[model samples]
Target chain A: MYTTWWPPITLSHSRRDQLLRALLWSCASVAGLMLVCIVAFLILESAPALSHPGWRRFFTDAAWHPTEDAYALWPMLAGTLLSTGGAVLLAAPLGIGTAVFCQWYAPAWLAVPCRRLIELLAGIPSVVFGFWGLVALVPLINQWQPPGASLLAGICILTMMILPTTSLLAQASLAQADPDALRAAAALGFGRWGTLRRVVLPSCAAGLLTAGLLAASRALGETMAVLMVCGNVVQLPSSLFDPVRTLTANMALEIPYAAGRHRSVLFVSGLLLLLLVISLVGSATWVRRALRHV
Target chain B: MNAGRAWIPLLLVLAATAGCGDSPDARQPLTKLSITGSSTMAPLIAAIGKRFERRHPGVRIDVQTGGSSRGVADTRSGLAHIGMVSRALRALEQRDLVGTPVARDGIGLIVHNTNPVGALTPRQVVALYTGGMTTWRPVSGKDASVVVVNKAEGRATLELFLKYFHLTNAEIRADVIIGDNEQGIKFVAGNPHAIGYVSNGAAEYALRHEVPIKRLPLTTASAPPAAGHPAPSPLARPLTLVTTRRPPALAQAFIAFAASSHVHDLVAAHYFVPLAA
Candidate 1:
């Protein structure tokens, strides 16, 4: 049984196998080590701002005037959460629905092309989306509202940018549903809609949740498109039409010119974004684990 | 296994060859000069550097842009042979480094071309920025809410704008916080009711390229513009090159070239006012 298709286990082959394993192990360790180093560096750089006597102001202060010693983080933090939340709320349902449509209902030709188009949407660089939003979407919104670059614009752009991620992941998850279960449902006289509602969706709950969470994280970390479309005012928005700035956008906008304590504060903002993304991923893992248990 | 083993040595050899080309020989010494700081002055300095390089085949001028503070830090730390600062050295900066004026630039308020407001007094400008005047109608423009665009902290233009207006960063009630002069100009040009202040040179260059934004004259109560002639920019600053107290001979030569009449055309081409001979 062992000798039928196996290549002769020569010394050179064994040595090469060991070498490949070693190479892969080193690569994996290097990636892990780099992540640790990045976390350490962020903590070190942000220590100044974190340890400052007036650090409490970061949560309480109304504005982000770092030069004036106001290190308010709430507004930008709120901006990040709100825009990403809005994007996820809008994109998840539409994306999952698109996936369901393509997987079950659409004709083969239409499904293939539609899937490819959504994947294509993922490939278009965020900067292009940002440019389009600025030149096209912002003005369109401005016609109805006074200022175009608002939280609403940011959310719309993020939704477009993250839709591909959610849809593609959902399609993959839908593809993972048991064929036997589908056949059983069909044998029991279940229609497409009934089969989808009772069997397809429940089986793919973990994957759908994972898809939504991944998209949320992507939206949270998005910088260029959000920076361009979001008016980048360091204030909590009073309305959807009001301009807002996110933590990521704030760092990108300031890091080029930031120095001294100002630079440290930007690092703190990075650390905050990292924590937010981690919590999202943690929740995703917890949900997946709970789903597996059930 | 054979193919994998064959590829390893080939990759090693390729990496070795790639590393070998960059090592300099002692015979033909390459004199590399690093110039850093001031994104505002980078284009002008880079243009001058190109002309300087053409004259000396052995020399390379590497121009980098951070902000003006990086210019001072790098010059003092000897990381850069020269640093381009868009403003005159402050008393603190002057203690460790010397700055030579190469050109002049003015910071001025810019608004969309369609905006009817012609000029803003110092008080009116302050009021608009501090949320005192929220609407353009008060400033003689159409009945629309004005969008005040402010620059982020650590920008030289922001510092100059704040200093000239006699306001602090905390005072500004900005609707949009932009990063650079180009961003400010582009933002103003895109929004009919938006007003932003940026480098006069940049705004002039933008106007030449048909970016629909106009610079408003800086007016004060003591003096008004004579008929036909607009008030000269009140927030003018020198664009200077900074070096340590004792710079190398090559650095001195480059500085002289940057300031001399030879590169005045280059300075003017960048829309900065060339220093009078």
Candidate 2:
């Protein structure tokens, strides 16, 4: 008995499936809509500054004097890049090394504790880390140098913060490399070193790169710890010792007090940061895709 | 069976959305008066609140500390019954609120006790903050980079300092951007060459407590009143109580209690200058 007609009163199996699909679609759409609304709102709010005469000057000029209408973002933009880049540079090697050690070198009993330790490190709140950096690391730096809160201190703190993400992800990806390949390499009169280099390392290169990019993104978005350590100076950092202010730190420190044109300028800088992050993630995905094709 | 099973998920979705709604109020017996804003005014307000609560047994006074702007915003939004502000209302902010001067405070520059800087001419102070002079040699005769510590934006002390110096916040090249008076004092206290400004009351309290920080006086007598107060030395600003509308009877009583001459000892105890009799 094939009843092809639709059930109007009762929910048929297909109709129920359709309803569930629609509900899931609505949930997903809500998330997507939130992101769209945020981007649209930021752009709309920032349009006045974007359309101003000094708008182009924002990218070119280095002096960020909002009261005098000099709305430059070079220093902060550079600071964000330098700090994130420094963190990635320090964390990547350490993270990859730890990942490699855990995957291939560590004994069976040691591996679980090592991974657990890294996860615990990740679980610690950022403010706690910032406090430690303030009470512990700042004085340590001060003992070595005069002005303790500087770019180096920021880099060091951010490096510690991002390490768990980089290493954990890299470790997961490294685990996916074919165990058979290692066995095959061993069978071919290759040493353990040779097996890791030729068989294991090449297979996980893209994953390692992805981990680095993800860690970099995390470092880029960090606010409190960097704000606490970076000293919030609005200057082009000439050396690692010089204090610098990031876009996030600037927003956190100034947005409370900003009004009028100053307010517009801060919103525009936020838009700029949003764009920078999008481009960073975009490029990372593009690279990952390109690497997959290769 | 199918309809009943389907209702479970639908009911869950509804429940999740509806779960956050408030439970019906249990009758609150206490007459609550919320006071928020101005960390500078927090201790004074807290002390006064205690005595007020003792006098009126059923009344509760809630004191909170954020910046002065939070006070203004909270009062405007009706989130707070009264706001404590440490600076005079700007011309634009004067609308829609009534301000009562409760106490006086002065903005003073603090330096490490190791630094021998006694007083700065208004010109020298401006020059130092603007990064025109980097070393302490001109101000205190130390061969080190002058670590100019400035306040984060929107603080009353920062606003007063900027106005007094005839400088915008951006013009100053600060090595550190501290959040509050205590933080500014701490930064200056820790570093040998650091100079930062905070409320005179806070600095005085810290100094008296043997904190290794000293308040610097402004040497320019007859410096314009627009800069701060014409007090001839310390830059004086008022700590105010603000309300968006005529407060409720209880709130008005609290206001009168806070403003009366009886609180003079309380004001002086908190290290703020008592209002002239």
Candidate 3:
């Protein structure tokens, strides 16, 4: 509160706040600009395609047929949800466990190396993972299933890719848990796992959720590896081994040669992706608000 | 005198280097026609653009190869002045969209040179891709799996190969994967148990495996033959220059020029068959 504590500037006290506010405003505007640009392009591009009953069929129907133009999103949506859900299912437990290991159980000597390996795996390019999965992982998976590159292959890849971020965040959150609470729980004769579950994990729930959201975004926008491994068949996915495609992969694959309404349909697909992401964001915001109220 | 003489030689070398860097007026920067599409059409489009620029100074043509499907889509969305595709126009292709044939490219199945199985019937290739033949045992007289390599999904090659062969829902064995054309070639060359198909232009005939891995013959498409294009139709499709609307004047000029007989010979020399009648 003292004058010496003030930021250095030859201006009135209000100037600093004004500059800070302007900087924040500009940063926010830049991000908003990207969203606006995508929306504008999507609306304009999809206008032609959306005019037809085919658009409704595409959005509502479960089937997709390029030969007959019976485009549909239900099957694709199901595939997307399944792959992403499977990824989350695998990643959540491992991520939390790894975080727990890093935050509490793992020897200090092993922590950095373990984290680094996870990071390196995640940092490897998606295309590299695609090649590796195709060359190495899928073949292994095929030992059980006759053919590989199934939804399961994609999920495994996504899990491996998402692990580093999820674990890192969970680690940070768990690390930030109140020491006093853990000490009290220990004093009360609670076991280490008991304290971790009852107290530490509850406190870190917020960060864990954040990690989940980050992984979700990765699963959604993921194009190359999933495209390579997901068998790209358009029927409703029946099992984890079923071949599938994601919205982004479809756009990447189809956008090149599509014309007129078909091109617009791809953009519409993009718009659908945008809406899906926004809905997730909305839910995340709602969760945060509810958490704050609690 | 020696200093002056040395300067003259250096200047001459510099002049030659600069001259060779780009033709002073060749491939001029004019209407900025940006074309992107199939890697198969890349060389052909680049050849056409180079000739187009040489003829029309001050016009720039930017041609990109992102693969054919994207090219066609880009043209539809007006993102490209032209799109080049290796495959024919699908039923889903825009009604207003039209294409002029640049050349006919022969597609051939490629295998590891070490693969002793010299050639496959089109039926056999179809069977292999549709997951009918999973092992190299019968073909090579060895007990090993046949790694079937395919283009990425939604690729023009997948469509062309499938449609031509009358196969459906063909999946690349998750176990056998190649990232791109080059990788697929290398994978086949190195693996000794892999098979794939590539356009003749994109197919490396001079690679170490080229001689060993022979091009599998494709049966002719059922068609009424016009005079210029012969029977046994070379298993070729028309490589097209796709634009959303007719390209700007300079690009159109180049397109017209590409359709000319002079460049037509150049296309054939590059091993692309002349466009279908």
Best-performing candidate as measured by lDDT: 1
Q: How accurate is candidate 1 locally (lDDT)?
A: 0.87
RMSD to the true structure for each prediction, in A, is 4.1, 6.2, 10.1
Candidate 2, residues A115-198, lDDT tens digits: the string is 999999999888778767765776567656757778998999999999999999999989998878877888898986787888
Model 3 residue B80 CA deviation in Å: 6.1
Per-residue lDDT over B89-162 for candidate 3, one digit per residue giving the tens place of the 0 to 100 score: 76566575777777777666787666678556677776677777888776667666766666644556666666
What is the C-alpha lDDT profile of model 2 across B109-221, one tens digit per residue?
A: 88889888888888988888998998888767777778788887656777788887789977787878776677677667777778888887788789879998887767765
Distance from true location, Cα of A263 in model 3, Å: 2.5
Candidates 2 and 3, the one with greater lDDT: 2
Rank the candidate models, highest TM-score first.
Answer: 1, 2, 3
User: Candidate 2, which segments miss by more than 4 Å at Cα?
Assistant: A1-33, A139-146, B1-31, B57-66, B77-79, B113-124, B138-141, B204-233
| Chain B: TM-scores of all predictions | 0.85, 0.83, 0.74
Query: What is the C-alpha lDDT profile of model 1 across B1-277, one tens digit per residue?
Result: 6646767988999998986552222224448788999888998998999999999898989999988878887888777889888888889888878999998887888999998998888899999999999988887857888888888777888888889889998888888888888877877778888889998778878988999998888666345644532334678789999998988778899999998999987877777778899
Please tell me which model should have the higher TM-score, number 1 or number 3: 1
Query: Which of the numbered candidates is closest to the native, going by highest DockQ?
Result: 1
Better of 1 and 3 by DockQ: 1
Residue A105 shift from truth in candidate 3, angstroms? 1.4
